[model samples]
Target: MRITRRKRLLIGLVAGFFLVFVTGLRAFDPGFVTSIRLLGFDGYQRLWPRTEADYPVRIVDIDEKSLAKFGQWPWRRDRLGELTTALAGMGAASIAYDVIFAEPDRLSPHRYLPELTREGATGTELPDALAKSLPDTDEVFARAIAGAPVVLGYAVLSGDGGSTPALKAGTAFAGSDPTDALPAFASTLTSLPVLEAAAAGNGAVSLSARDTEGIVRRVPMLFTDGTRVYPSLAMEALRVAQGASGFIVRTSDASGEIGVGPPKVTDIKVGDFPFPTTERGEFWVYFNADRADRYVSAADVLDPQKRAAIAPLIEGRIILVGTSSVGLYDIRATPLGELVPGVSIHAQALEQILSGDFLSRPDWADGAEIIATFLLGLAVIGLVLAFGAIWAAAIGGILAAILYGGAIHFFRNQGLLLDPIYPTAVNLFVVYAAATALLYFLTEREKRFVRAAFGQYLAPEMVKRLEASPDGLKLGGEMRDMTILFMDVRGFTPISEQLTPTDLVAFLNALLSPLSEEIQQREGTIDKYIGDSIMAFWNAPMDVADHARLACRTALDMVRTVDRLNEADAFRFRARGLATQTVRIGVGLNTGEACVGNMGSDRRFNYSVIGDAVNVAARIESSCKAVGADCVVSEDTARAAADFAFLEAGAIPLKGKTTPIKLFALVGDADHAATEAFKTLADAHARLVDAIDANDVARALAGLASCRALAPAALHDFYDRFAERIDAMAVAAPA
Candidate 1:
């Protein structure tokens, strides 16, 4: 199907927003960010359970308890010899120490490198005098080391030049090229300098994640030799644990990329665009720390007695020994926290890569980000321009915040880092700023429209809504239950005719200002105005529940307002000059269905009320002046206005009607008690209807007089009008 202009605009806006959101992903690192937070301190503990394995490579930790029982760190080498011998005796597969032995023990004959041929040693000098004078501890330690699978610790560093030790034939990593089929980029990998001689291959633990500002965010996976990549600490641990010969690296020919892969699914989440990755495989982390099966600390197994504690914990485990103590200063800052262990961070990355649960940002992510920003900008501008500045601002802020938070969550939880920061921030700034500028122009234009449409007649608020939802400005009507009010300033035409044009305009401005403010304040919509009159209604545009009460209350408030105006000292109008003399206003209220909204020709449209309810309200207002009552309301309005006290005026013939309409006067605040008393008396008068029906006119007439006495002056004045009409009707009745 063909799409409309608005629909096409929506589609384009959405497409643009997605593009912007995805492009933002390139600004962040996935594995580095996710690994740190996911494997927090608590997560780190899971990799290291405090228990021994029965069969396999295991880690034994030198806990604080073991340290207290044994000697301090760097114990006599003979003790280490004994521990190694015991592990060899237990048939351990292999023993790897995370500790470094860069320096010789002081107890050795040379105090650094003792000669193997030395037969015996007592103090610093091994006896050259005797053939087998009992070798020093160094010889004993060397003997133990030769008897077991002892893998020593070594670290790699980057430098301009370094001496290359002769390669041990069996010690190098044996593997296929892991990156053979990968796409190439600028060399971001750093080199490692390796020189060591122990039992097995060495590995690196270098984390290289960056922060929001693109600083290093996490540990690197593997240390390189400025040419080739080597296994990391965690990878080495996995190798030791699995007893694997080496990592398997598979490669396929470029044109020989024969197999069709599964279709990829992209998640365009709610927030900012994510960091782009080359493919699905780049984001992940390995988990390793504190596992009884994986790590061993040197401080534990040195003591022969404490060695039992470790053997039970590390006999068949793959243990990683990294710093948890704050003072070790091995912690690195991450999005997760500043105290995350540098070593464990690498472990998490390894785990993710191995599990193949990487956060994928396709090369298309950049386009996604650009699109997301554009779309969000359009939405923000549209809302702001279509509504007002306040609503537009609210929507823009909410959308921006949601998108930003969503991108971060997707990264951390799903291994997908959609970079939302830049796009969301840019969207908010650009959209709001642009929308504000546009709105300012629209507002200025609207003022002109207001002047053209209603400056000659209608209220300012009406003009604002007309511009706000211009669709509602059509000449149509909706039937709505509304409270209609009619207000007239008594005898204003003669006064206006006598005054100059300037004085008339000034007077009208002054009088209408407070009166219009009063109506609007009560949420009453002004329908229209006759000469010196205000016709308004409630429950339109937005419906109010107690609109009838609101209408009546506004009428009462207007009555009080006139008195205050008459008392004011700023007397300029003809009526304002009169001393303490109140100007009279007649108000009528009715509640019923009326056609409301713009109700006129296209050239001269107006938001107004039409139909019988409006006519009755006007009739009631006119009846107020004719019957000498300040305010009159239909019984329907009176019933709905529970807040105001109402007193009944007997039914009277209204002009252009044979049916006598039931009416009530609106009593002001002081008359509440009197009005309530009148209700009671009126109830009694109604009961007298039964008396009159029984031909007991005496009691009926008596109750009527009682009702008159109890009512307030306004109600009584209405009752006197009723009495004159009743008397005339009775006299006019034929015998």
Candidate 2:
């Protein structure tokens, strides 16, 4: 649970790498990430779409029905002339052709006249008058366009070098020339000179950009061929309809950031409508599904009877002329998930401009996304480290919801396209997954260490308790009131010397195995093994309410267990014709404040206890050997284990202590403590301890002798040791 600095740095580096990868993807505008971004954009449109299409823009669709009624496409320039005349008569604002007139009409009289002249000619001078009398179909269409409010469309090619459309709108650059920044075209295919010249304005119909998936999501409002910038069909239509003489292009200023230089066309002003566009002068079209309300069949417009019924629809609207006929191959994909006539894309852009509802992903939006990615990634990592995976996942989900919901809300309510998909996917899922996985591995390793270190020393339940809360096992010390136990086999060197190394190991395992179980069963953690000695403690790495009582009870149980082991060993040794040496252990229990936790250098550490209390416990165990008792505990521990019986051992100044402290010989559990004999012995032993602490050598001797007479076999050695101490004090006294 303790995240090292190195691990944190690694986590941060991984998160940073993701941010950089996404940012680089955005900078390069790679097709895959762009595809996902566009998909998200499409999702936003679908969830809460532009439900109203109220702009005065209509598409004169040359649909399947129209093709059926009016014959196939290239419906004769004269018929197109008639259609244009009809719309002009109906008071249409502007008529823009999404169809390009790149070449002279094939059905023109010029073509037939030349063919007929050749058919009838011998050399020259054949059907000259007949050729002169035939009216040219292109002239007819050109004349009609000249007479009507029409904007001619053209296609811009990448390198197919063709004629460029004339820039009808007077363009004035507000900042540096934006031709370099605008979408570039090597050449163009415009209407025939006669037709383009006669039309009120000319604009490019070719889309400057397409999504990676080949969906047309935006149309450039302007494009540049060399140094000349030209407007799109939709922009030109709106400009001529509004009677604007020119377009005012606002480019970025040179005074901005040093490396950025001047930006591309930022806004294209046409009369009173100031349209916001991408740096490339493109507009994100908030498309509506191909709507019946926005269409008027071209055939219907050409039909005299039907023309009257549809006149209102085309009247006073900017009519875009293009085909929706599938055979014509003019249909294009849109965010609305429908294929609409390409002309409808132009119509929708013009509609959005006129309505002043735009979808914009500004230059600053990229910066915002980068920042969000970094911050959200950090938050996720922090949450996972501090609170673990479950809480981190909950918080991550909430963050993702907020981002997605906010993006949708902005797109629907404010027409601001703020991308949430990249940040949510990268930060919430990708970064979260990386950080969580790293933490999981690190924490699991820590858990394994805890289990391996404590598994053999603690009970299964205790190991589970430590595993469940490994965070408490910080690699530093904290002072806590603890009960430390130190147990050692009494006089084990002689027993070890009598046996072979294999026998010694077997003997040690047999003696330490049950002792470890006794300590672990009483909720004690074994610190380590020093030859025959096993040091343990309670109330750390986790909490135990009656730690002192548990330590005392473990000591009593250990004594009883060793007694049984000694009996078993004695019988086994006799049967094998070996020297019979009993296995006896001395246990010391001390209750006081000590520092407990992982200790040692960074490379190697041990979860153990230190300070005076721990040292005194070891000294108490050593004292047990001199007293010939199995267990000795400090007065503090004796008081803590109120349910157990303790016979007071005369005070002795512990090693490194200035004052003598009282000690107790742990006798039995609560049941034994209630016996009349234990109560009587406890009273007599307490009196003897008081006499010794007062330095009343004569009185201490008398009290010790009386206790020796009344004591059980277990306390006889305890009494005899103190009597010898009193006699020594009496001998050393000044005369």
Candidate 3:
């Protein structure tokens, strides 16, 4: 097939569309694409997790053992005050709580005394002045918080709420407004006013999943509640430890970042350390395997005997007060597949910033990926237009391999994130789509030749197969095992005499249409129509499974079709003002090896079979009238199609064969063959053949009688013919 300029241009248009669609998807960056891209970055972390190193971060866990040592949660505020005082005494650098003190302590003396004074019948009231003198537990906890560098946590909400988080640090930005890029919340949930005011820093404890399935992959460095900005728990802890007064943030409009198209937060500085952040002022934390050394049981911290051992771990470390108890519901998932306390995420974020080992996805990554995809995908489409899809796809595979290798190298060595999936997919899809369009055009151009050759002879589906792959079929022949069929109308000469020329054509078309349908429906190829007969065969052009059985089934179906046509008044005998006549058909089947293919010359040919088996089938169809059977098959077909109800017709002299060939009468299908009546008829017919071979006149007559008694009503004529043959044999056997 030669390429045309118009077709080549069409292919180009198709390939270009594919490239655009894929590149546009990357630009749109839907949730699914984000998920796959994030998954690639996650694979890097899983391959080489962050190394476990000593950092100034620790979790003072209120685990199940701590609960057992003290009591269940919501313990009196006085105990929390004691824990705070103890940490301060140990010289802890910073204490960040992953818990909310939203409500006042219920165990305070003033709290219960006022309730008792209202319920006088309970008789547990104290004097108003004495109750006022008693200390408030929340106040005690607040005083302890004031003594140490404590950062209290608050929750972020997306729904309607009235409360707002306390702002502990003032944010100063250089270029664009930092609040424009940071995540904004509708409202916030803050802790108790006294505790929040007394703490050195107040920060958000909440962590957003982004697209990591509830896994903490990104931590917000700053948040906004529409008007005010707030720092995260980790950021506040870092600031308090360093004794920094405020934060410095920079954006795209800054001096060094001015050429960018849009404003995006570029850098943040807490005291002496300068750090980079995502456009939304978020920090990407590289995670390591959870370290057991990073935790100290709160119960152990309060115990006098254990305090000495834990003091060294707590002295310079930023202690996060949180619970690891399953009942606390403070657990969070990570890329490493471990569920750790929520406080650990905040602690890790600080560790990442302090250590200065980071992973960053630059703003230019998407543009780079799109440009690579368009250039590479265009190369493949050009190759498809010039050479074809095969060469183009081969080169595309090489390009994809190179792209993946570079992406993986960047991730491992440079700690940079790049997506290789979108570009590779674009190349593959454009090449495949262009190739399919080319095939369809080529097939359409050559289909006329195929349709003229086998369109009339073979079924529509078979013609389609040839059209798809013209190479598979050629002007040649191959010997294959096939089942041949020959069907003819009974008493055609007599019927022709009754109808006019036009009526004869009409009658034949009406009769042959249904009979031909029966053959084609069973996957048999109709070779041609000879007068009132149909010649067909199976297992040609394509391999038909169980071709022999299918032939037998077609034979039975044609017989039934003719009977139906006769019952439907299709003969048209009465319309001619003559006595009504019935229609009958005879079908012959034989299975054997034969040469089946295009048998004629190159320019003009027909897909037909030619061999001794085909002749045998024609001869067997002629013998149907002599045997008084509607359907007859040779011994070869009977052996292959034993599941059908076939009774032996004994050895008879077929015209061309040297010896007599055995024949069978096909009566019914597999279900009828399984019946006891068919079994009885088969047994009696076998005995009759044996007696005829033995020349036992008495036994032969008796067997013939038994066969007639067991056979169907329509088969009485067949048994009568068998009886006549037996009588002729007895006479020739003269004693």
Candidate 4:
């Protein structure tokens, strides 16, 4: 189950490919992703909105109330002239008309009298003096515009009539030419020549070209007619109010970095404020839903009595003259989903720029989103592979929450329009789901492989444990503290030689069945069997905290079970006319650092342990026959098993080893270990080993004799080995 370098590379490439795919999609910005982004923008506006209209911009709406009071649609041009003159007299900074005066007013005397003559066919032509005395309605409106701060609005049409409006603001560029980057118009719908000539400035009133979902999200600050660029209605109004001379188009090349592509217009500087825009010079309008505080009815402004009521609202404020009447067809959609007068869009843009609280999507936003998607996706992939699907999902969910929360914070506090939903969906759901599914499939495959490979050798419980955490079945060993156990029947070879092959097989199985159960019950993994002996270890495949103690306990339980089996075998052997010899087993347990994992070739391998410690456990088992003990453990095991009593056995140099390791014979569990008699026997055993090491034969014999009398029957074999050691030392000593 090891993930090779090539496999890891492939995984990274897959994730990288996903990142590249999404990033390219973002670059191209197809309709679906754009729609998602717009949804996020709408959510931000809804969650944290500017409920109050605090900017110094007012809308002179020709609303339903005004239409009711002033008759019907397209009220007399003299009345519109009177409204304009009233706003000018009230100290308004500037009055911009969102309405276009395209044709001559039919109410004017110049046109009405001619219509009267055509209908009657008997009336003589009016006198020249009388005709000259009657005032023209269009001339009255133009005179009103000439005497006040007024910016007339014109439309950029896509049809014929290619007449361009006069550009009042001087145009200049700071860097590369910005004419190519500005929004282009094929034709223009302008006011009458008298109105256009009388106005202080004229600008295009058309919305930007990129309003998705029919929402007026952006408004162009300027537009081009092939030769010259002119400001929009909102921009022209602000320029006239501040008495600014011209528009300063700041291009990307102004920053002194030679850009890869054609330079884009980054900002439009007017007066003291520089408004940030998209490459096409469009401003993102932060809208408030038809605030009542921002509106003053045109009827109220025109009436002398109500004029005083609205004079305070218009003093030194930029006023937009537009209609919200449904019949006028000037209604537009905003971020809040409210239909407001189209003039409100221009008013909001100017207000946002003047208040310095505009929403901006920086040029580097795409790169940031792409990088974030890649890193987040990679992290989720690694988590799912290293842990599991559930854990990876939990972590990914947390990150998603943080990402969205951060986006909201930036939008509310910093006025940034970052798209959090698109990036989050790509990383958390798209990439994470794919990686989790792949990991889950590979993990199940690994579990099935583990079960098939170790099913026959390991106990059922052991196989189940391996299946639960198949990541532990990887090839190559991990160095860990492990307790190794080696068990063998005492006279297995002689006993096997006496039986037929079939009988030997049956006998071995009968003996090994209970032994394997004892080992598995204590959470020991059986490595392999050598003839009648079993080699197993604890703390592999899964961690066992008290591994050394568990191995010791399993060894003792195994010895007791073998003895019971031997009693049954003795009775059967006597009836069969065979020798009445019982079976016995010796076990050796050692605890130390060892490398435990699968070992061998690529085709076949065994989950086993190897190191000097494993060899020492085998050598310990071999020495068990000389000591006449059922089980022996190294000092490492005795220290870890606090509940058991140990009789200290003398150290012996194991075969093929330079250093000798000390050994202890495990006696019983805590209850027996706490007995006064066991304590006395343990102290005596320790003294006997110390005496023998110092070559004091008299003290060694006395100590061994005392232990033999005080110890349980299990200590008899222990004392016999010490007695032989003392005798050998006495014979080898010099006089």
Tens-digit lDDT track of model 2 for 44-97: 888766768567999998988888887877878988999999999999999999
**TM-score for predicted model 1 compared with the true structure:** 0.46
lDDT of 4 by residue, 75-180 (tens): 7788889998999999899999998888889888777776676687637777767777888999999999999999999999877775878878998888888788
Please list all clashing residue pairs in model 2, or write none if there are none: none
lDDT of 1 by residue, 540-571 (tens): 75556798988888898888787688777333
lDDT for residue 235 in candidate 4, whole number 0-100: 90
TM-score list, all predictions: 0.46, 0.82, 0.60, 0.70
Candidate 4 lands at a TM-score of 0.70
In Å, residue 417's CA in model 2 sits off its true spot by 2.2
Q: Residue 706, candidate 4: how far off, in angstroms?
A: 9.3
By TM-score, who's the top model here? 2
TM-score sort, best first: 2, 4, 3, 1
Residue-wise C-alpha lDDT for candidate 3, range 621-648, written one tens digit per residue: 9899887899999999999998999988
Evaluate model 2: give its lDDT. Answer: 0.82
Cα lDDT, model 4, residue 68: 87
Q: Which stretches of candidate 1 lie over 4 Å from their true place?
A: 1-58, 106-109, 112-146, 161-195, 209-221, 240-243, 251-283, 286-312, 319-460, 463-735
RMSD of 3: 16.2
Question: Which wins on TM-score, candidate 1 or candidate 2?
Answer: 2
